[model samples]
Target: MLLHFISDLIRNPELQRQFSRDPEDTMRRAGLSEPQREALHKGQLEPVMKHLRAELASLELFAVVWVKAVVQVGSTQPGIAAPGSTLALQVLGDFFTTGAFAVVKLEGADLPAVTRSVENPGQRGSVLSCTLDVPANTPMGVYDVVVVNPDGHYGVLPKAFRVE
Candidate 1:
C-alpha cells in the first residue's frame, strides 16, 4: 500500500500537489500505516525505503532525491530534450532560496555525465527556475537527473529524461 501510494505520488502531478499542500491528510487518505505515516511525517525516508526494499526484492525501485522537492524538466514542453538544447528546470521545494547555487547533471548510459551549474538561482515562493544547456556532443540515451544544492544535499530522479 505504501509502495503503491509512492508510485502514484511520483507519476501524478495532482497527487504531488496535494501531498505538498497537506501531506498528512493525503497520507491518511492513502491509507498508510501509522508507522509509515510517522516516518514520512518526520522526513525519515530511510526506514520506509528499507521496508520497501525488503518487500520488493525482485522489483526495480524508483526514488526521488528529496521527499519535499519536485523537479520538473522543460517549461514549455516537459521532459523531452535533445542534445544542445537548453532545458528549462523548475524546482519546487522549501529548501530552495534566492542566490544559492544548484548543480544539475545527467548521469547514465555508461558515459561521461553532462553537467550545468545554476549560479545565483532565483526563487519565487517555493519554486526555483533555472536552465541547463545540454552539450551538443552529448550521447543519446536515457539519463538520471541529479541536482545538488548549495548545502551539498542532493536528489536523484532515475531515468528522468531521454536524449534523442
Candidate 2:
C-alpha cells in the first residue's frame, strides 16, 4: 500500500535519502506497481487516491516522501519533547518556495502553526518544524505532525510525539 511506503520512508532515514536521490529506484525496491510508481514519480495523487479508493481534497496534488524526524536541533531522535520546544522533520517532495505550510495536531485538533525552514531551495530534502504551543491548560498527550506544501499536497507523520 502507498501508506506503507510512506510509513517506511518516515521511519527509515536511509530509505528517505535514497528516495530523494532516486525515487524510481526506491519505489521499485518497495515493490510498487508500474502505475503506482509512475503516479508517484510524476507527483500525481489522483491515481493513488483511486488506487486507495479514497477521495482526497487535492486530487492533483503531489505526494511528499517523509525521510527523517529530528525533534530538536542537531538530533535525529524523534518524539518525547517537552512543551515549547522546536521539532524538525525532513521530507523529500515538491514544495513552493512561498505559500507552503505545516501544523501539529492532536486528536484531530490543530495545536500550533509549523514553520518551514527555508533552506537552500536546491537542497535534496525539505525540513519542517513546529513548536508545541498548546496552552498550559492543554492536556499532555501524543500529537501528529502534518505538512502541506504550496501545491496543497499533504503528508502526515505516523509517529506520534510524546510530551513530557
For residues 1-164, what per-residue lDDT tens digits would candidate 1 score against the true structure? 67878889988999999999999999999999788888777778798897677646634333333332433322212455688787665544334433433333455333222223233232323444557567788788766655545544545556665778
The segments of candidate 2 whose C-alpha lies over 4 angstroms from its true place after superposition are 1-78, 83-97, 114-116, 120-124, 129-132
Model 2 RMSD in angstroms: 15.2
Number of clashes recorded per candidate: 1, 0
Root-mean-square deviation of every model: 14.8, 15.2
Q: Which runs of model 1 end up more than 4 angstroms from their true locations? A: 1-77, 99-125
Which candidate wins on TM-score? 2
Q: Rate the local accuracy (lDDT) of all candidates.
A: 0.58, 0.55
At residue 5, give the lDDT of candidate 2: 82
